[model samples]
Structure formats: structure tokens, C-alpha cells
Target: MSIFERMKQGATEAARKVEQTVEISKLKSQISTREKEIDRLYARTGKAVYDAYSRGDLSRSETEVMDYCEQLSDLHEDIKLIQEKITNIKLEKSCSACGKIVPVNARFCPDCGKKFPEDDEKPQESTVGEIRVLCAVCGTENDIGARYCVECGNELSPAAGDRSKPNDPAGDSIV
Candidate 1:
């Protein structure tokens, strides 16, 4: 082969390789999305059942059991399709968000708009528990649960030395 022909062939092979990799990555992502959808459907079905049980409504659950069963049947087909797509992928860089192939360590998915799918991005769980307090005076509560009532503007949990009531500017008249 001539020098030009050899160079062109080499370039063509490289381009083909890149194309294959991208196609494979896209296929994997598509499969991941589909599988996630199937999982979500199943979860919803489970939740519906649980809710029926929690409400002590056996009759309603029985009526809806057929619908849930049909959803599970549909999910099987979805899983099959996703598996086929996964098998066809030629390259793999699994997404962290949903566990599937990406074009590279891509920052965002061109297909799904997911950011940093193949990287650890889970938020750290907070260790501090929520705080709530009840006021013993004026029967009003504050969001900060401060030692004072927000509605009536009364100081809460007053010290014994400060137990004396303030002089009423309105002449101590009972309204």
C-alpha cells in the first residue's frame, strides 16, 4: 500500500475504535436507565402493598393485587431489554449514580443529564439530631425554642429573683 493509503487505513481503524467505544458506553447507560425505571416501578408496587397492609385494609389489597402482579410482569420484559443492551456494550466505565457505562469519567451524561455518575457524590449523613422545645409560659412556642414566647412576647423560665411582674404601662387594667 502507498504511504497515503497506509496512513488513511490506520486513521480509519482508530476512528472505528472510538466509535465502538462511544456506542458501547451509550448502550450501557441506556440499559442502566431502563433497569432503574423497572426498579422504581417495583418499589412503588411494594409501597402500595405496604400501605394497604398498614391501613388494615385487606379487601382493598386483594382488589389491587392483580394490578401489582401485572406491573411485575411488565418489569420482567423491561429487565430483558436492559440486559440485551448491556450485553451489546463494547466499552465500560460504570456510572456511580446508577452503575452503568459512561463515555469516560464524564462530568455529566449527554443522554440522561446525570452529573458525575461514575464518581462518589453521596452526601454525608448528618449526625446531629433535630432539636425541639416546649415553652412553659404564655403557652406559646418559638422555632428556636428560645426561653421566651414569640406570640405574647413573654420571657420564659424566669429566675426566682426576676419572678416579679413588670409594672403595667396601661395602669394594670384587665382587658
Candidate 2:
């Protein structure tokens, strides 16, 4: 074949390969989307089963499902604890009157105008040597006077501790 003809043939073959690659990428994307949809459907089905178990509609005779339900319960508790830690890190408190989140230092709830108690006015102080000062961001135990966490280098609050006071009505405790 002539040099020009050989070059044309090579160009056509390269074009075809590019088209095939594009098509394969499109197919893979569609497959990934379908897989995500399937995962969501499975989650919904699991939620339905868990709801039934919680309502006493499903008995403990099904040991497999009971185990799954127990795992879900533990996961839910873990989620709650993590959420409380997040709230503490944000220095926020829920208003008792309206359940609206407000700044920890606020004397009254901005949304509900509910006055916070005297003990809730400020973050409770950490008694030196009596309690451990843990970094809220990294959960690393630090010395009472340490300004930052050693493990993650996250800043530790001076008043960080079990914020719950003996007189706190809600009796909220932080770790």
C-alpha cells in the first residue's frame, strides 16, 4: 500500500479504538449508577424489616434477622454518641423549651427566648487532676494544661471536660 493509504488505515483503526473506549466508559458509568440504586433499595428493605422487628411484628425465631437488628441498634447508639460529640464540639446546646439549638454561652434561646439556667451560662471548668482533658476533635487524652492534642494536633479547649455539672437538670455528660 502507498504511504498515504497506510496512514489513513492506521488513523481509522485509532478512531475505532477511541470510540470503543468511550462506549465502554459509558457502560461502566451506567452499571455504577444501577449498582448505587440497588444498594439504596436494599437499605430501604432492611429498614422495613428493622421497623417490623422494633414493632414486635417479627419474632426472635429468625435468628439471622435478630442479629442484624441488634447490630443496627448498636450502630444507632454509636450514631447518637457521635452526634452528641459533634454538638459539643460546636459549643451548642438544645433549648429545653423548643429544642432549638443555641450557642452554649447564650443566656436565652434566640428562637424561643427561653432563659438558660445559671450553670448553663458557661462551659463547666475541668478540675485539675480530678478529670481527664480529652480533645474533642481527636478523642486524644491530653494533659490539663496542654493547648493541643498530641495525636491529631487538634486544639483543646481550656474548659473542655465532662461539661455536665452536678446541678445540671438535663444531666448531659461529654466524653
Candidate 3:
């Protein structure tokens, strides 16, 4: 090929690459936006379900509740994929003791208590536990696992040591 033809071909190839890169960036931005939208939709759906349940309305006419349940399975799969992507994208920060992934500047790992660089903090997973507690003073609902109310800041009833149980013949203790 002539020198001029080679130059033209190189320019065209570079332009195509630039276009491709732009397209990829656009797609990434769109994905991020859609992810936010999905999150908002999930929150709204959860609220609707809660509201309907409070009203004792279990009818299937609620689109938000139905959509949420329908999306739950797909969302779970998407969550795993997102986690994998995050694990891949984040900078590697290994714990010196256990050789596990740690924050870039972690002061101490609850797992090993080994000081690691704690740079970025990711949201932790939520686990399910059943416990019921009613605040004594404010009569506010408190988490069974919580030591204090998040709203009223009232100290929760400490786990009784059966002191209250021994006094009564009935097995019921102060909860």
C-alpha cells in the first residue's frame, strides 16, 4: 500500500477505537443510572408492601408488591454479579496475618485484629434475626439486638439472669 493509504487506514482505525471506547463509557454510565433507578424502585415497592400489609390488604392488585416479589429472584442473581464486579474492581489490600482482603487502611480486622490499611469501606451484608423489644419509658419499638433505641435513645431491657423468673412460679420472665 502507498504511504498515504497507510496513514489514512491508521487514522480510520484510531477513530474507530475512539468511537468504541466512547460507546463503552456510555454503556457503563447507563448501567450505573439504571442501577440507581432499580434501587429506588425496590425501596418504593418495599414501602408499598409494608403499607398494604399494615392495612391487612393481601390482595394481588398491588403492582408494587407483585413486581417486587417477581424481581426478587432476578435481583438476587444481579447482586451476586455486582459483588463479583466490585471485588474485581476494588484495589487489592490483603491482610498480613490471614492474607485476606482488607481495607487499604483498616485499623483492625474484627476477624484477626491485625492492623491493615483502611482505604475504602464497603457496605456490610444484613443478616436475619428475630427479637422483639418494647421500650419501657417511651413505649417505642426497639431492636432486640440493640442496646438502645435508635430514635428515643432509651436503654433496652437487659437480659434477665432469671432473678425475676425464680420469684414467680410461672415461667414468664421480664423481657
Identify the leading candidate in terms of TM-score: 1
RMSD of each: 23.4, 22.6, 23.0
Error of 1 at 51 (Å): 1.3
Tell me the deviation in Å of residue 44 in model 1. 1.2
Alpha-carbon local distance difference test for all models: 0.52, 0.57, 0.54
For candidate 3, the TM-score is 0.34
Q: Which of the two candidates, 1 or 3, achieves a greater lDDT against the reference?
A: 3
Evaluated at residue 51, the lDDT of candidate 2 is 75
| Model 3 clashing residue pairs (backbone) | 104-117, 104-118, 104-119, 105-117, 105-118, 105-119, 106-116, 106-117, 106-118
Candidate 1 error regions (>4 Å): 62-65, 85-175
Identify the candidate with maximal lDDT: 2
Give lDDT tens digits, candidate 1, residues 67-127: 7677767766776766555544432244445564533323443223356633433232221
lDDT of 3 by residue, 11-125 (tens): 9867865875666566556557657767876887878877778888847438767777677656556755654444434423455676556433334432344544434444432
TM-score of each: 0.41, 0.35, 0.34
| Each prediction's number of clashing residue pairs | 2, 0, 9
**Cα deviation of 127, candidate 3, in Å:** 48
